[model samples]
Target: MNLSEHYNALFKKSSELILSGNYTIDSKINDESDRRFGITLLVRPNEEIKANIQAFLKELKKTEPHQYYYPNSDIHITIMSLISCYQGFSLDKFSMSEYVDIIEKSLVDVNEIQIDFQGVTLSPSAIMLQGFPTDNSLNVLRDKLRENFKSSSLPQSIDSRYIITAAHSTIMRFQKKLENPEKLIEVIEKFRNHNFGKFTAEKIELVFNDWYQREKNTVNMCDLYLR
Candidate 1:
């Protein structure tokens, strides 16, 4: 199918899944000592963009009051997962310093990526703001980082579905089964074509995950700036 057809199909399938309550939460299997780290494009939206998205989120909360929203501080677009201590790993073998060095070297010649938040889309577990880069700069950076990881001793993501093939910022997640799924779907459809805002992604961060918490938020370990 063509691009439009492909997205339409994906949206429809995702919508159905959201309404059916058949999606899984973003999580991994790990012991108490394990930590998860993701290599991602840290999107620090400007004040204007932040205000616009916050307003939209406030509106969403009016209808879906029970849903879980991501904090403004945690917004980012993942490029790929680097390591998971769950599957036999230690900081000594794959240090955060090493990850930063790899990302910095790989992105030495890369430039900042301009991304436009054009619309909202639904996936099984989260509501995402779909992003389109103004150019292929983000893709080029991702490719370069992937190449760096290929030659490193860092272990691949334990979760097979955690690959970053698309650029999206997850805005909200379902905390419980919605009592009125159709109504929620209607509200989301209204914003399917809404323009959220735009921002430049300047750095890739090595983020550490605290999975023991209820929200499972990530902590910024280090940043690699693009030239």
Candidate 2:
């Protein structure tokens, strides 16, 4: 199915769980010993879209302030997870120049992409801004990244979890047990069709980061521009 269809399906399933008070709660949120790191290539949403989502977050906070919401700085649409987070990783082990060269070649003539963030959706763990690339540019770019990374001898475990095709940007993750999920669900339903804004990405950033992508735990690595 297409991105829109997939987003709708996910919304339907997740919202049903919310209505039935069956949404998942993250217990590890308070665990300080949790240590995992990853390398991801992602696109930051435009300021207008970020402002729009932050406004929506204000509404959600009134209903459920206990849940963790991603700060505006961390809001992004992941293009690819080059290396999913692992238990032990040495950042110095990988050559920065090699990855840069490979990715630069991969984006040789890729088309520019426009992601329209049109609504709010959710999974048991998180609330997301529904994103849809206006054309096949996103698919083409992802395919190129997978193909190029596979050909390179440098270490990369791209798509080991699953082949990513969605453009959705996760905005919030459950940090605690819901006090009244029905109330939160009502807030979610209120913005079910809200228009966040559009993000026509010009560049994608590759970063070494902790699982949460916290600014303090992240190091900027490379900038890849779209055509």
Could you give the C-alpha RMSD of every candidate to the true structure, in order shown?
3.9, 1.4
lDDT of 2 by residue, 1-227 (tens): 47778888998999898778788877765677767788888889888889899999999999889888888888888888888988777697778888888777777767687999888889988899998888887788788888998987889989899879898888888988787788888888899889888878989899998777778778888887775
Q: Clashing pairs in model 1?
A: none
Off by over 4 Å in 2: none
TM-score result, candidate 1: 0.80
Write the residue-wise lDDT of candidate 1 on 1-227 in tens digits.
13234445667998898678776554342344445433333545566766777777887887788777767666666665565434433445546666777778777767887878877777777787777777777678777777887877766552355545566777777766666777777877888878888888666666655432223545566766664
**Candidate 1 regions off by >4 Å?**
1-7, 20-41, 84-93, 211-217
lDDT to native, each model:
0.66, 0.85
